[model samples]
Target: MGAARAGNGSDGIATNLPEADDYCLTARDIRCVVLDIEGTTTPIPFVTDVLFPYARSNVRAYLVDTYRTRQTMDDVAFLRAQIDKDLADGVPSAVLVPPPSAPEEEVIDALVANVEAMIDADRKLPALKQLQGRIWRLGFDGGEIQGVVYDDVAEALARWHGTGTVRSYIYSSGSREAQRLIFGNTEAHGDLRRYLSAFFDTSVGGKREPRSYYEIWQTLGVDSPSQILFLTDVYQEATAARDAGFEVLISIRPGNAPLPEDHGFQTITSFAQISV
Candidate 1:
């Protein structure tokens, strides 16, 4: 929802998958692993059901309050550009900027209004990602929301990092600050941030694009994609990572994943079983 499926691997690699292996990294071949949030570590519902909506509800307020800030002005540019593109396609401003609150369609209507303007202005941007991230920050800090990590994640990550050889990271559409907030606020062993080394978001070309992973590799100064293990619940995302040469792991867990008959990769249920 942020940009990519929450499975880039981990804080170390860049995904959160439903399944992992018992013989992959094994505390030797690799020094770092990237993990994803969402379905990989934190359950999808926490993100979708709570984080997304909370941010959605607060975006309007953020826009109004921050509209004068340099960042919000950037969002205006973002919205203008989106508007221009839609207009070029024969759309009209009437649909672009509807009345402030159109009942059940207020939120979406606002988005359309801003997006149309963005396309019109020719600005491909990250205003929304930024705004949502900021709003979510307050919610997280307020204790209005709680991040959920799978039951098995705590011990596995603890053991993996406890080896003192492996490093972990986080990559998600969420902002770097949001990543810290979630991990730091997680129900499992509060403040997991110390275990993580870095954070990434859609600014990295997004997960669907192969270049994001490449950028990650460059940031890590890692030798090769093959040296890092990319984990996720979405096969399409794993495919992009695999294409980039990062070792791939799939996560399959109850209520989190839809079973695939021919995934063509290793699957895992918990971090406790992961190996390298």
Candidate 2:
């Protein structure tokens, strides 16, 4: 299923399915390669089955145990602000009871419950990402969480960054710190963070929105969005990048969801299949 499906390539030309060479654009003109995390640079199971579960199972204990620490307080404060916003917007969500006057432990308990619920629901809230990133830092530091980046990813990153002309970046819903933790603690290539030039997260904008791609392009200091090749497994992401004028490719990796046959974006089975 990792093989590319039959579809129209990004160039608006139809070709034999999975013809890697045909999708390989001229490398000389490409200036940056922005990658998605799950299913693109890393396997989906590693995230859905491993990291997320780890975060979810440990969140309550981690939060309650570290409630007094400055880092924990900062995250709690952010979550509180988000909750306030949700309440103001009339969104139904768990809230810290007896606002502004609740005992510290009680407030922490409520926040922990809300955060855990967000994790279970798989909501991409910034506060949740921050809390998870902090927890994952501990796991990574203790050797309990070794990130699982795909074998081809390290090589492709090296090749792209080897040239002073082309740079490599990561743009995922994961927080920048979470992105750093994974790349910095990968099982293969042992800290491939050196190969990455920068990281972007949902903080830039929603992945499905074209404006997010534009913000990424502007942040990369590139004038032409065409100089950047955005690789992701999700069709919506590919469409967003294409709309933003960045070259796009649908990554077909083991454990990734099947792409629609009629999806017009070009597809590649391995990073090695991509030239730049």
Q: For all the candidates, what are their Cα RMSDs to the real structure?
A: 8.2, 4.5
Worst 10 residues of 2 by lDDT: 13-22
Model 2's lDDT to the true fold? 0.82
Off by over 4 Å in 2: 1-22, 25-28, 87-97
Q: How many backbone clashes does every candidate have?
A: 64, 0
TM-score, prediction 1: 0.76
lDDT of each: 0.68, 0.82
- lDDT score for residue 203 of model 2: 91
lDDT of 1 at 202: 74
For lDDT, the strongest prediction is: 2
Residue-level lDDT tens digits of model 1 in 56-119: 6676666666656886666556655555566677755424534334453453456645543433
